[model samples]
Target: MIHPLDKAPEQGEAGLLKRLLRAGLPVAPTVAVALEEEFLRLANLQEQIGLLFQGVFGARIDEERLFYAAERAESLVRESYLLPERAEAFLGSLKGWQGPFLVRDSGRSPFAQARTPQEALFALKRLYASRYRVEEVLERWPRLFPTLDLVLVQEAGAPQEDPGLSLKAAELLGQPARVEAWEGRVVRVILD
Candidate 1:
């Protein structure tokens, strides 16, 4: 289900995004598509992972074969489209909002990559497809499967003088560190 940013779900990327927003950071309005929806779309693909490996290597699949199988599965998922209802919900959430929304994978490294409806769609698919990437398979296969639980669609933030801000949790010299970009370069780091 699609949940508004203010009502972000209790777990995963949605929660993190909400916390970031609540902290009064300059973030855009966001909505999170729950992990359950992604699980539904990807359960079949996950199930096919072993089969694909077996079909290629006759049941004794090595790391390379497993990776290849995962890649195949990711490709298939990339080819598939989001569920109709989810798509509708996504589009509906954008009502009254301006154009050029940014769609990001909540579970992965964040980026404001989508600037158009078509680009957003492709970004969403790519987010889902990232679950099956070779590195992902090498890291998570046999222990965990990737889930499509969190797609964050937000209003594209206007260009700012600062490129971005990054907070470091571990104390840097006994205090929290904040990195800020100035004039497109990391010119200052404040310890608070």
Candidate 2:
């Protein structure tokens, strides 16, 4: 049987993919680009699998290769984009080949729910930063924040009278005067 990696790149993507998987290569950039399309060419998809596996294995390529590659790919796809800032860090640490192979998820937010006025305000601020204006989020889901409720708890550390973002947030929300000051920058209003 021909080793998957040894197959010619042109055997179309299917044959090439089979070869690559059998050979245990990492993911390919071509595959990454194709991921946008609804359907994928198997050969190209195999390429991406190879590239991801390569990144995870680092220098110790041969030992425990399949196990490490699978774990790395899963972690990258699952958590990377959600917390983009930590994505690179996570990748870098994996390359060094130290520490536990798996990191457990401890499901607990210090402030569980946005019950209190302060919690509600913080939630809204984070929503604006991470979820609201993010291009991908908006592109994928258009009517995301049509009915948002913003409640101000304490004044965000903006200039006293200026109220920097607080006012702007209200305008963006299309509910300015509806904004009510609770404590500081926190205010409560429903998105109507």
Candidate 3:
């Protein structure tokens, strides 16, 4: 879903295709619009895939897991235009949460993964500035084509939180169910 930098503005629908001309420079088309497009892209993907996933799996998937799988998981990968460009690594959600998060921005190249307040500030800026879920265009990010490569929102590293909420006890359906994880975070489900 990648388009050349020169032509990105024209095809505004495909935000994933748009690339920042210079990684060091401020994000093109202003930071606000970029943010809108980013969230719109995410929300749209959620809309398209969420329905299908719920239909097949018959279980609700969290926004974090859906976005992560859309970006990284092999089983969830699909050649859909609703997806982000490979040029941009999928950073997980950045909204409705608190601090102590490690934002990964592997835009063009990799750099020191500073777990300092600097990265957190950058994410906060994106969170506050970008206008993604608005009734608008083009999105916000706080995750623009700036120096950021990946935008992380959940537990850093591969590990995720598992409170061991039993499906049998919660659902109370007496149906067999299983929860699976990748590197500790729950990623898959099996129900019978």
Candidate 4:
């Protein structure tokens, strides 16, 4: 259920982006190669569903929404990891919340303040599906399409005081392997 890059050495700005969708990319071309490749890997394997949704939710979660959510989760996941320096800014704003909670974004967007569990589920589905139009448009001229340039605003919200610090601190307290790895990123990211 774990991937090599899932636990990264990066955090904060280099770790996250708060950018508009219609602006310039914030990451180096060299770094984007890895990002895009991982993105594509998820995209290609999405049809299988189970491979993409593990660890995020329990096996007992609603099967109906999970299937559609997994199929559409790529865009939100894409939005979450896009670097601030690499992603251009345009349109509405999207901010991540905590513990599978995303909200209080640009008004008129479906993801903002999901009212009920049903609303939240639908919001996630719609949010993930948001990028299909862009990709479909770009599909015609794949060569002309810019990678990591256009980034939408959205986050896979998690419940935490500070995501990088809190989660790693929790891990540092319990997991030896994770402690050594996260210790450095915590110091480098939080103290530096």
Candidate 5:
């Protein structure tokens, strides 16, 4: 059973029909009542259709997958509310992480000028196992960049440990950062 807050009177029911009537539907109120009943039936059918999906997919669906899918669906629904009018400055704040920067270096602190963004990001994920947990990091990153577009985080280029940039990250993550660079090669990051 769904909590009352999670339930609606089967959308397009009596209340909806009454609302339509009040909003100037010429149909009789009895028609509204019929529509409401029909809508409830449709909702029941929809629920059955969802059950059918679960039955067909059940053999392949594990509890973890179901939980993750449900969580993702809920998040999508909730995130839809974060539009420009509602989110304002609070939107970009998601990008700020309380943890350390997940740097993606190519094992060389100096840029090879050959490493692609994809390669760099992959390397970063490999270097920092804890930070690359995409879903969790993403939740925080939205505060920095509000779009649900994952590319914003995916395209953050490669972060290298440079004196200046390290200082920036240190200030941002609020920790003393030990700058590591390949000897004789300066650490450089292309800031987008």
Candidate 6:
């Protein structure tokens, strides 16, 4: 089956990332698992949580109690199996990729950081589990739950040569900032 990330734009940040790459930006290559798949995983996880807790607490558990239960259930998410084909495709895409990777959330207020493959996989599981975290739930309580469907698996970019540029930019902007430089060229300006 064609994984959603294989297509452009429609698969969320994958499209934007591709466009950036084509435009000669310094972003590394990435692969992603679609939102639909994540939705299914989340739904299944919720069902499993219900089953596991129903006998002990019954179905009338309040949101606070449910949040606790969800935290406990997070460990199970690491064991949730990925489809063999999808796993193969994801791994295959990074066959010869060297250095560390980055597993990032592709949603509003996205965060990105570097990791090895094993670390990235663990992070991915945690990212999924984070959907039900107490703080996350509180943040999205009004929305019921915010969308957290996409994962960005990208090769780690080279380290900044003069990280002082970030400090300088922050000083000038009167806010935190990061400078992403590659091949002696300043590629990105991130403000915080």
Name the best candidate (by TM-score): 1
Per-residue alpha-carbon lDDT of model 5 for 116-145, expressed as tens digits? Answer: 433433332233222213353345533311
Candidate 4, superposed: residue stretches over 4 Å from native: 1-111, 134-136, 139-192
Higher-ranked by TM-score: 2 or 6: 6
Q: What is the lDDT of residue 190 in candidate 5?
A: 30
Q: Per-residue error at 37 for model 6, in Å?
A: 2.8
Q: What is the Cα-based lDDT of residue 125 in candidate 1?
A: 69
Candidate 3 lDDT (Cα, 0 to 1): 0.30
Q: 5 or 6, which is superior by lDDT? A: 6
How many angstroms is residue 130 displaced in model 2 relative to the true structure, after the best TM-score fit?
25
- RMSD in angstroms, all models? 5.8, 23.1, 19.9, 18.8, 22.6, 6.3
Q: What value does the lDDT take at residue 169 in candidate 5?
A: 37
Better of 4 and 5 by TM-score: 4
Model 4: per-residue lDDT, tens digit, 1-192?
A: 111112222322223321201122221110101234344355453343334444434545455654555445555443443333322211111112222223322222223434333344344334434433434323532232223221112233322224544344444333221111121222111221
Give lDDT tens digits, candidate 6, residues 65-93: 76666676666565676666655666666
lDDT of each: 0.58, 0.29, 0.30, 0.30, 0.29, 0.55
- For model 3, what is the error of residue 38's alpha carbon versus the real structure, in angstroms, after optimal superposition? 23
Candidate achieving higher TM-score, 1 or 6: 1
Against the hidden reference, what TM-scores do the models get? Answer: 0.66, 0.16, 0.20, 0.23, 0.20, 0.63
Model 2: CA > 4 A from native: 1-48, 54-63, 82-192
Worst 10 residues of 2 by lDDT: 102-111
Question: What tens-digit string does per-residue lDDT give for candidate 1 at 87-185?
Answer: 777777777766556666665435456666556666776777776677776576454465445677766633232424455211322345444332332
Model 5 regions lying over 4 Å from their true place: 1-79, 90-157, 163-176, 179-192
Better of 4 and 6 by lDDT: 6
lDDT for model 5, please.
Answer: 0.29
